[model samples]
Structure formats: C-alpha cells, structure tokens
Target: MPRLPDDFDDDTDGFDPDHPLADQPALAAVARFARMLETIPWFSRVGDRLDADDRAAAEDYLSALGFPGAAVVPVGDWYEAADCAEALDMHSLSWEEEEHLRAVAHETALEITDEEALDVALSHVAHQAASLVGPAAVLSMRVGGLDDEALARAAAGYAVQACHQAALVLAAGLGAEHPFALKFRLYERGRWPVSITGESFNLF
Candidate 1:
C-alpha cells in the first residue's frame, strides 16, 4: 500500500520487487545472475556463517528476486553451464605459459601456512602473471589447455591461492573457514581458474 519512487514501476501491472526498475536492463541481468549464484551449492554453506539476521535478510533479498526456493545445484553442473563458459571465457594455453604459472604457484604455495599469507601470495602471483601476458597465462590452465601434470600443478597453485583468499575474508570477521568449492567461485570471478579439466577446485 506504500508508494514507490518514480524509479520504481508498479508491481500490480506485473510488479517484480527484485527488479522494480524496468529500464535498468543490467540490474535485471544482475538479479538473474544473483539467482544463479544463490543456487550454487556452496552459497548456502557460505550463508551458514552469517548471523540469523543476516541470513534472514539474505533470504528476503533472494525471495524478492523471484527465486524463493533458491535450490542448490551440483558443482559440476553449474560450472559447466554455457553461461559459465561464457563468464569464464574458457580458453587454452601454451605449454610454456602453463609451466611458468605452475612454477610461480608452487613457490607461492610452499611458504603459505594460512589464508592471510595465501591471499598476499595470490595477489603477488596475479600481479606477476598479469604483467607477463594477462590472465590467460593462468586462467588457461582452468579451461582445458594443459596436460595432466601441468593441470595438476595449476590446480594446486590456484587452490592454495583461493584457500588463502577465503581465509583472509573469513578472518576479517566472518568466523568460518570457507569451503574450497565456494572459494573457487570467488577465484573465477577474480579471473583465476579452478582447473584445466573443469574439475572442482579442492585443497585436499
């Protein structure tokens, strides 16, 4: 019964609270994307760390987006979707690039014992990789461009990096160790890859 601003379109004529503005196509697209992200299995695990109020708020936000159920999906299925491939910009890499990235990842992973250390290392490696030849040098290893040995090394490298990054975030007061699967999503969004074989990125 309350009035919405000029920015919002009335929902009665088919109102969608999640996307009250009909003109902002990008926001509408983000609403859809958020729906997909909420369905990711690890999202709930991440949500479990939230306080009751935060959890309730998250649920309300998702419900408003028209995804009241927000069911979780298998990691593989979600990662393999056509949209994911597009989002990931799946690609291949040369053996030389793979080797270089693996070596860098190996060195960084060796000294990291916790998430904070790992995050700093991840940043350093990403910066170095970017300076070399952009993200493809490392991201290629996640999209089917490396041999088994190379891929293993690549995955290990990124896994450690992701674990560390997630740790830092959790310690910053979330009070939980994030699962590797969830961290993997964060990694990809940051342009880091999970594997060259489209497998789940796990630390163990």
Candidate 2:
C-alpha cells in the first residue's frame, strides 16, 4: 500500500485545509473548480458530445477560474494504455523508452509547478502529453528518426508528468489527503503507481 510522507500527520482522517502543504494557490484553485464541477455535474458531461450551452458553461467556469480567452473542446474518446493496447497492437514501452519518459517527466514536473496557473495548465499539458506518447512510440518503432532521442525523451517526459499532475489535481479536488495524494508523492519520488485498492495504491 502507498504511504504518505513521513511528515504527514496520521491523525487526520482527510485533507486538512489548514495543513501547511494544503495552502498552495494551485490546490486552492483546483479545489474550488472541483467543487464547482461537482455542483454543475461536469463529470457527467465529459463523454457526451458537448453542445453550445455545455461548452459555454465550461468556458464560463474556466474564465471564472482565471482562464479567459480559453475554449472548451470535446474529445472524441478517452482511454488509458491498458484499455486500448490490444486494439492498437500496443506493447509496453521498452526499458530505454521508459527511462527517457521518466527523466523528461521529472524535469517537466519541476518546470510546470512554477507556472502561474499550474493547476489548470498542468491538466491541459497532461492531455497533450498523453496524445503524443502513442504517436512517438509508433514513430520510434517504425522508422526511428536520426537523433530522435530528444523527441522521444520529451514525449515520454510529458506523458509521465501528465500523470503526476493529474494525480495531484485529483487529490486536491477529492481532498488534499486522499489516496491520490499519496500517488502524487510517489510520482514526486519517481515511483510509478500500478493500481489503487481501496484506500491505498499499489506502487512500483
């Protein structure tokens, strides 16, 4: 099972808003957005083909959260690697590929946390990163580019960093001390979480 940081107080049953680590601006923004999302039933609209009104409502929510001039677009579908691997004839990333991705993700994580609206930006970047991973892998496997290491590494990095940011955002919205929070901490240490069982995560 995943463990919290040694410094975390074990007595707390859930996220303590008053906790020092919970005082981040990013976390606060995400928490507020999460609450708003719940109120508006945003998650229910996720897979639906968003109509004009749905798009407007989403944009309005984002604008209120300090993202003006941003547009909300619908994705055709959402699937994790495990979900579509067989259909796509996909295999796990090679050891070298994994290393490149992890290294890049760690570096990107450090860079993104410094952004002004990290909570929002990170989520967007995470999606973009996920999109790139498949293409990058396919390209590397089919016709490796000359000196493609940089591109490959970058793709891998963004993918992992996306997972890290997502975990953090989810934890913030759920509660600062939720199991996802532990996942975030695990990512911070360059560890991968394989699964969630009840209140704990299975880490690798």
lDDT of 1 by residue, 20-68 (tens): 5344332332233223322222212211223454334333423432334
In model 1, how large is the Cα lDDT of residue 57?
A: 38
Q: All candidates' TM-scores?
A: 0.23, 0.25
- The C-alpha lDDT values of all candidates are 0.33, 0.37
Clash count, predicted structure 1:
2
List clash counts for every candidate, in order: 2, 1
- Candidate 2 per-residue lDDT over residues 40-87, each given as its tens digit: 111122234545644444444333333345444343322221222213
**RMSD of each predicted structure:** 19.3, 16.9
Candidate maximizing TM-score: 2
Question: Measured by TM-score, how close is model 2 to the native structure?
Answer: 0.25
